[model samples]
Target: MSIRKVVFPVAGLGTRFLPATKVIPKEMLPVVDKPLMQYAVEEALAAGITDFIFITARGKGVIEDHFDKAYELETELARRGKDDMLERVTDFMPEGTTSIFIRQQEALGLGHAVLCARAAVGNEPFAVVLPDDLIAGNGRNVMQQMVDVYDRQQGSVVAVERVPKDQTDRYGIVETGELQERVAPLTSIVEKPKPAAAPSNLAVVGRYILTPRIFELLQNTRTGAGNEIQLTDAISALLAEESIYSYEFDGTRYDCGNKLGYLQATLNYGIRHAEVGEAFREYLDGWNNSRDS
Candidate 1:
């Protein structure tokens, strides 16, 4: 079945971003001109995902408002002959597509957050795009690449990228078999395993094309790492029954959940913004020259 729906788990407390996130959802942080979540949504749109299921928590209202049509503002813009602005505001949702938001009442682990999306996903396979993993792709979105891989493999596909061996403990590291070029059949998945015991440095990124069978596995999954239901634990069990593959997606991922990553993403996206890139490059060059002097 074609992957039509995508679940975005956005209920985390975002403690890493503290004060600013106290009022604004971390996903609402601006990347360049748009919020971080907007980039993820656009990427999903490019991947042919028709339904957007947001598993959210409190203080995420900005996310809902950002994607919804601003009727009042649009009316004013139209009255003022601002067609360009109106087009930008009204062009968000595609025709005949669904954007539903489900509230995740408690702060649970990623596994529990995904479980909240099971009803919307039904029996069909769907994709999961973590907004925190702001992937900057040259052309194809990371999720699009995974979906294409899934079409051929007709199995679950997760996005993987090589990380430093020492950083394997920070992610769900994948153990894979012989590769088919960029895609490899996953042999196993170890979550936050010690660097010494890690199977490989091929770490699973935040994108996944998962089957509905995972809902049952997630339901039975127990609390893990940081006392929350880790999605890695459930995927580990699902691997025992179904075949899952890892696609070494070509993209640069920014972990917006971390302070350093967030700052870096701001700079990266700012430097790439069409309206600002040239001026920003000049500014950066001048600043670096001044620092040396």
Candidate 2:
């Protein structure tokens, strides 16, 4: 009831990233100093989520290893008197947090990947975080903001942002009744509507706070675009049964699923990194001066 669990749908093959993603999972791709998945996990952790359900695939074993304790590495770092590096490695995963990985045998759609976590999710409301959508929040993270909305709404809440109307075809667009400032009650949701046909510019992002009932809806959802079951279709059905709201979360989201967005995230995070922030900024300024001259 307090939203203690979260589902991470990370099983997709990163074909967009081509050769780099051929071996490494896109979720494992680093932004600056940390992997994309680590940021998602840290965000959820900030929201007090203790149980994590990772829907994974065959090549995603490295992700599991990423979260697991690096005993040998830690020991070596300690032996070498690298306390700072050892702390960083040992602190990757905090104690008392549970991580469960479920294999998505086939590369289905996002909806299907979520359905795979039904057993692990059981009957509680859970959050679904897509690591590819690296959201940098202002003060409060996106998932935390949605959980607060769920507390008041007592239904489902999806994270939405005002995307360019022309890019409506790229994301699931939501139709809303009226705006309660940042939050709005959804009237309907259409997956990947064309620019001309899109209901509104507000498009659903990666963060979701869904009830367990969604698993049932996902089970009956037919494959839509890309010949795979669409989570938007399931959420559209749930709209008929209960109230679902969309929150225009206060955050900057990087669509790390594509090459441009990934590079942008790396540059943005790199410039602000604690260790290299000032130096990176200086390097950028020097590069710009050199290029201009």
Candidate 3:
């Protein structure tokens, strides 16, 4: 079946961002001119997803508003004849695409956040994109690449990338069976294993194309690491029942949830922007030369 719907768990308090995130959501933070969440949304759209299920919290109304029509801004832009800016703001949501917002009242774990979208997701296979992981790639989007694997295998697939052995404990590390060019048949997954205990360096990223059976697994999933319901636990159960493969997504992922990663993403994207790329390149060159002198 074609994967038409996607779930976005945006309910986290984003405490990492502190004072600024106390009012605004970290997902709303801009990379260059676009917000982080928009990158995920655009990625999903590029991957053929037409329906969006946003599991949001209290202070995340701005997210919904961001994708909606900004009438006042549009009118002002019209008055000033800023047609370019007008198009940019008004083109947030594409026609025929459906967006549904569900409230996740608690700051539960990732598994619980996904379960909150069960009703909207129904029994069909759906994609889950974590906005915190902003991926940069050419051609196919990460989700699209996973969907291609799902199309061939007809099972669940998650995006994985090779992490340093020492860093394996920081992520859900996957044990491999047979490796194709880009896809690896996953044998098992261990969440945050020690460096010596890690089966492989392939770590699961935030992008997932999950079957409906996962919702059931998550419902009965007991608290694991950090006493929070881990998505890895549910995925492990799914792996036991059926085929779950890992795809090494051809992309550069930025963990916008971390302060350093967020700043790096902003600087990287800013330096690549058509409007600022040349000037920013010169600025960096001058700074580097001065430091050397």
Candidate 4:
């Protein structure tokens, strides 16, 4: 069966973004005109995911409202004869697609947040996407690549990218055993290992195609780094009984969880945006010239 379900873990405190994130969820932060969470949802839809499950915490109700039907806004736009704006809200959600919101209830780690959606996911393979990691692909969307990998392998697949050896400790590093086309059969995964102990520079990123069994493994997993239950640790345990592959998906991923990555994403997407591209590029050129002088 095709992977039809996806879990979005949006319960993070956004501590990195301090005062702004105190009220606004970092996922709601925009890259140009689209928010990170909207981009993630659109990517999943492109991958043919039928169910959208959002595991959120307190102060995240805005995300639910954002995805929900805005009847009042649409009606007002129609009354004002703004068909373009009306169509935008009317078409915000895909036809025949539905969304489910689950409460995480507590400030837990990624693993716990994922497990909160166990009921919504049921007994099927699903994709897990972190909205903070806004990945844009050239030919196909990021989740589409993972879905394609899942079709052939029928096992779990993760989107990975090579990082510098010294930076390996910043992410969950994996060792490649053998190649299954573009997908690498993972031999082992070490969470935040030091540079000297890192097996490889391949760092696991946000996108993941996981089997239902992950819920079981996550349930038994003990807290690791930062005293929070780490999803990388749970996946490691699943490796003994099952096969999990990592594929370096074709994409330029923006780490929008922090300030720098967010700004980078804004600049990158801004220059490519059809409405603002020309003006934005001109502005950038002028700013660069001034800085040089």
Q: Cα lDDT of model 2 overall?
A: 0.94
Determine which window of 10 residues in candidate 1 has minimal summed lDDT.
Answer: 85-94
True lDDT of residue 254, candidate 4? 87
Residue 108 of model 3, lDDT score: 70
Worst 10 residues of 3 by lDDT: 137-146
CA lDDT of every candidate: 0.91, 0.94, 0.92, 0.90
**TM-score for model 2?**
0.98
Q: State the lDDT of candidate 2 residue by residue for 134-231, as single tens digits.
A: 99999999988989999999999999999988999999999998898699999999999999999899999999999999999999998999999999
In the range 61-174, model 1's lDDT, one tens digit per residue, is 888999988889988999999898788778778897899899998888889999999998999999999998999886887888888999999999989999998998899999
By lDDT, the candidates rank as 2, 3, 1, 4
The sequence of per-residue lDDT tens digits that candidate 4 reaches over residues 240-286 is: 88999999888898889888989999999999998999999999999
Clashes of each: 0, 0, 0, 0
- TM-score of every candidate relative to the true structure: 0.97, 0.98, 0.97, 0.97
CA RMSD for every model?
1.2, 0.9, 1.1, 1.1
